[model samples]
Target: MEKGTKFRIIKGIGLAALVAALVQTGRPSLAQQQPADSTETKQDVIRVETNEVMIDVVARDKKGRPVRDLRPGEIEVYEDGVKQNVTAFQLIEADSAVASSSEAKSESTVAGGTVREAPRPLNSLRQIKLVTLVFDTLGVESRRLAQQGALDFIKTQLPPNTYVAVFKVGNRLHVLQQFTNDRKFLEKAVERATTASHPQSEDLSDKIRKSLEELRQMGAAVGAAGSFAPPGTPGLVSSGAIKSGPPIMSGDGSVAMEKPDPVRLKLIEVTLNALRFTEDTQRASQGMSSMFSLLSLIRAQGDLAGRKTVIYFAEGIQVPPSLNELFRTTISEANRAGVSVYGVDARGLDSARTMRSSRDMLVAAVNASKSQLEKGSDVALSREEVMSTDTAESSLRKNEQGALEDLSISTGGFLTANTNDLRKGMGRIGSDLGSYYALSYTPQAQTYDGRFRQLTVKLSRPGINVQTRTGYFAVPPTAGAPLLPYEMPMLAAFNRHAPGKDFEYHVAALRFGASTNGVRHQLLMEVPLKNFTFTPDAPKKIYRAQFSLMALVKDKDGRAVQRLSENFPLEGPLEKLETSKNRNVFFTRSVTLPPGRYTLETIAFDRATGKGSVRRQELVVAPVN
Candidate 1:
């Protein structure tokens, strides 16, 4: 397609598709209209909930080193101000947490399979813990530092029982190395991460730049208000305000005040502000999808018992406050899934302070505007405009990095920031995970009403700092916003790509012999338990888990012809759980159709982590005699 044609299509379809994706995914509808009466507007509350919560507690000494010596008896747990019994407890070694890398390395040396499609024999959780190392080449300035960090981690810090996989996140997330113990394989993965094949972060664009540009455009439009004229007034209208007056657009996306009446100036300013808000809202809304993708990757490890950690290395991307709620929701899901996130600020020492001043940006914009003056354009800078520039510049990174730190702290991992020594940060992580206590509690309150619960873990001993998740959303197993009768999450997933880019799960469909009325399509939903974080609720020696499945069959017109939802509740003895987890969760689904074309969409979600795998397929039914 030609570039212009493609651009036109994107501009036309971006908003329509974006809204559909958000609504199908159960997010609040953006750009909802407000009643003309100011008093009629009311804010709708978003109720988020979760049942079980996992908090990773990291203890550190005065020198910021991991404190390995701490007992469950010395720790006290609380939720929403009430004390709760410590129901589950265990210790995880970075190297020996579940499976040490050393053991896996030795086994890789013995049996080698060059075939990537061949499935490796599943092993017990105690034999290995899965570590997925993601390289954020997009958000990081020092890709070399991040690469060395991973190499150093594999070469020096990999535990004997730990198996590490690699992924690179640039324009999109891609797998590098599958779970492997082989050091050489890991080093090669790290090397490939530094190549030019990685997408440039520049495509993401700078929000500060965008906001400043909006401000300049608004300023220019408002400055010309001096020549404001009324269209109906022959004297003023003849002055040419009507001729020069560009179309004014309203918040509701409707064109209003067609004539440039002096009275319309207020309406015009309101329209401009509304337009800016809508643009920002669109950008922020799209951010939620991106964040969900990252969280999905973090939770893709199936049936892997023990510690699941995603050390995300990024300078961080700024997300709007409206979207920050999604950030919290993703973290809450991670805590429930027993996933601990370690945020590695890839920028190391962020040194843009001197260059990122608002005044500097203002001066640059003024210079650019002067150059544009030759083209009959002008820029008006007001006190408010300067402050707006400053605010966007200074606060751009505050919450972005804060969100990263929130991910680390909530998951009982260290937020390593403000330093050039990536190796040292890796060392701290190694020491921390080497020896730690795993503890769980059944909250006194069992109600899963999607409310926030405060969590506090106090140490009996002094001079030792403890870290874990701050809180969790009390969401029930089936908690979610119901989609329209014709809509499902698969709609968004399939629209983006086939087989979904969110979670990691596999499914296969086989058509059974046709029946009289319709065909029986048997679907095998294969979910590897290792991809999920399993917490053994102690005292009973049972690890309970929940996996959800939803299938939708849409006709050629995209109408939902059939649908089904299944919630699989898994519980078994801890040791036996290992044997059972190695196997995939398989189930069959069927839908009957007449002679016609249709779309088959299936989604498997890890209930605890909120990660999902979506699969889409096209089906054809021939007429029967």
Candidate 2:
């Protein structure tokens, strides 16, 4: 019940009696692993020999027909001005692409007339087309159009062998649906996105418009008065401009006036409105949160093979000067994942409305400044404020539009804007996602200091346009080095207070005693067998299941000190498989750590159904007496 106290759930402990009966003899009753310290020296010496970078290129003829027959020799790939050897090349056709594991499974007749699932071949002719639909902040009309466009695309424009997933990014990221070819499920996800609400640009711009209107009204009121002082006049207000006859001495000896000068009042009002507009403009340009959420999503798909495209739907992403680097990072991450971002302006033809409002606001501020000057007022400060506000707002407007274009074009995708019919844009995206030439080459420099590496793809033939990512940031791939895409979910769960609800499991860590290697601890997990989904292996005459068990040990400072992961391939006689329902599975992993407080995080992931549960517990290693 205390904060930072790890909750220990000791369920299914009695199932230890059934472990021997369930596991085959001589294989250890349950999963066990040698101590991590024993292999630490060997793992520390491991280094990546060569890293291959993949690039997706879409080539089309002048008339817009795909030119897929181009050979590797005809295409030249350059990285940072250095031409590199093409290591891999593949032409992915829409109809030939196979994306999902379920769809890729093939059954073959084996001995005894039994059917066996053929192992998916490596480097096969068929590639995958993975597309993600991300819906961001939208107004009512734009949301409706986006929903309709998505529904139509799913119903008609969706190409064969393409897998689509739906996601919504608001204050945080929400996965509406995972990748699938089912049209009905995708449509249902679009329906769910219809009612999803976040901050709307329309509302933010409307507030700004009202402030500009107020400024204009104040300017008009000043212009209509002819008695105001001119630039050369001695005083800012004329002798009769002030309504008050003269200052009067009250009983308290405080000077009393009938009314304040209208010119001064109007000047103050104009300044406040200009300041409000500036503040609102800054607020409107904030989009770092959504960018971070998108980065997470893209990284999750880093290991996914084939062409991955993110069709991002929103009015436009606004990246202010402060967030420019973050925006670039988003593009770089997308390129690293081989994911293209196709930005669709949900406002369609009305996309320019914000810019128009910004221009109007600038005009109003400039006119107000001119009026202040004609009234013989000290307009130096106000004029500078107006000019700076106009410049900032204009820059923000340009950056908002530029964000969409840069994110798309930099990642080998295009932007769809200024059109009411969004479905046509979706159609183009489908065609673009379906057919592409994938190529990879090792960078000649091999330096990964996080610098942006410019990529140029040239063809020997003319009249053909090649579209690919501009380049990727020089960075090491960490997805499978020590951490994996599937492991990310568990790491996230380990950090958060909320436990995973996909299933229930128990985990505990016990420190035996101090040995020559410091301290030895055993990590144990007991999971119900019913949590896993078993598939009938016809050829093996048994039902088989597979799941990945991972343990992450972190020191008191929350830094991962050791990581252990292994896959469990379980199988049993088909008739006796029912007995697994009432039984539980146990796994043990040994970890050697120094005498310090640490946390052990574990996750049991069902590979068949894609379900997982993460549990954490605290372990304290005391010094020997």
Candidate 3:
């Protein structure tokens, strides 16, 4: 929680999916995404990408049984509210489907004297689904509980052949376990692992504090009387006295003391604001970037990977206002990758006092005083002040989980909340997974126009309930597509890049220490987000800058001991970023290796332009004495 503090994490190699992503460098050029079959002809050396939009449909009957017998005609597809032709439809489950497999109707016809599939695609008959369990270390209340719940579910509830990969998202994203059906290895991973943390959220006190402030503002806007008084006024927070309140808990469980305790309240407010900003900023930068990393992971998982469900367990996720695109982009990638996310509110059901703080009692005490004052004297309050006074527990729940639920719904995944027993939720999720189906469709008249597209799924039967992915970005077909920020070429897997000045950036610090795996090193890179070229039609006050980074630790043999890749997403006020350009916008990565001499290669690439900078630093991990 403090700046410059070193976080001990079990530093190790992440899931080896970046290599597969390397081959997908840039974007798809044409509809010819797949390689030419032996039965087909190589028309040109220039490859045209053949791709298909795959959607996983989870249909359930009125009684909640998995609807395993839905036919292709019974399902409908819509993107941006327009009907699309279902090119391929089939059921993908761990068990057999009640309905028969649909005929693999080849849309190809004789073209240029050779027969080819019109969609130019892979065999989209049906695919395999791998469940990805992602734990939010910083967001969840207890990491041990998350581990235990995950392990218990795996042992008792996980179906046979259901490959699962465990990931931890704390200060950074790390693959705790590779995708495997083996429960033994996974159980060990849950037990011995350390270092992975999830989204860092402020505690209950912070939420309550924020809510109190919001309610005050709302009350002021509503022109309420004797409620919350606005700041900069005669009585509230504008006092020259600057009194700090003692840390006393009142009846309502909020900071008790007197009104306009700006000194302490502001201190607490500032701290909470910092934490909130950090969480939102990380949500856009690291959280979404990690999701992009999974596109690469899908390659290692398997080519025909079916419903790649990432069961994301977190207390809550609040996307920064300016960074909503990051969430959208993350979900779009998931749609393209056919990955469904099952979001579990780790806070769970019950305990109405969850995330409560001094703000609660503070409000009641202030209001009680205000009520007596209003009865005795004429005291007018703003509408926002009144609204702030009335802000309730529901507001906190919505504030905490609204974004998370939207994300889950957008991805056509189930969001389990209102209860503490996630094991029961996990059972439901596992059962739903058993009955999920994959639907692929080609656009009849639509073109990849390099824009965002909204997708919707519908069922023909009334009593049946179906859930599937929401939408995807319409990336117009191109002759060549630029690589995503994190995509790395295989050749650069080793620390091959020498320190050079292709771009302007700074290395804030690099510290080395001992860890469970081996010697550990942390590298921090700082960049001025304002230096980025601003895209058109962005938020009025906010701007976005995108870049990709890769770090590699290579032994003296030129073998890469560990590799780190990050696609940095920056969003904030244009003015603040410009003014604070001299200040640090830091990015950190940790690597662990056996005591040895190694080359640490760091690369920063700007996606807006293909320009980048690479630095190779020599790091020696002395034998632990």
Q: lDDT score, residue 201, model 3? A: 19
Model 1 spans with C-alpha error above 4 angstroms: 1-52, 64-69, 94-123, 139-141, 199-290, 353-399, 477-625
Mind giving the per-residue lDDT tens digits that candidate 1 earns over 284-384? 22222345445555334322345667777776644433234456666765676667778887777774642354345546545533443333212322222
Clashes of each: 37, 0, 49
Candidate 3 lDDT, 60-132, residue by residue in tens: 8888788877666666787778777676655555654222453344332221122222221222223234677
lDDT of 3 at 416: 77
TM-score rank order:
2, 1, 3
Question: Which should have the higher lDDT, number 2 or number 3?
Answer: 2
Which scores better on TM-score, 1 or 3?
1
Instruction: Report the alpha-carbon TM-score of model 3 versus the true structure.
Output: 0.49
In order, what lDDT does every prediction score? Answer: 0.51, 0.58, 0.49
**Two-way lDDT contest, 1 vs 2, winner:** 2
- Higher-TM-score candidate of 1 and 2: 2
Per-prediction RMSD in angstroms? Answer: 27.2, 29.8, 23.3
Question: Residue-wise lDDT of candidate 2 within 118-141, one digit each (tens)?
Answer: 233433213446677888878898
**Candidate 1, run of 10 with poorest lDDT:** 1-10
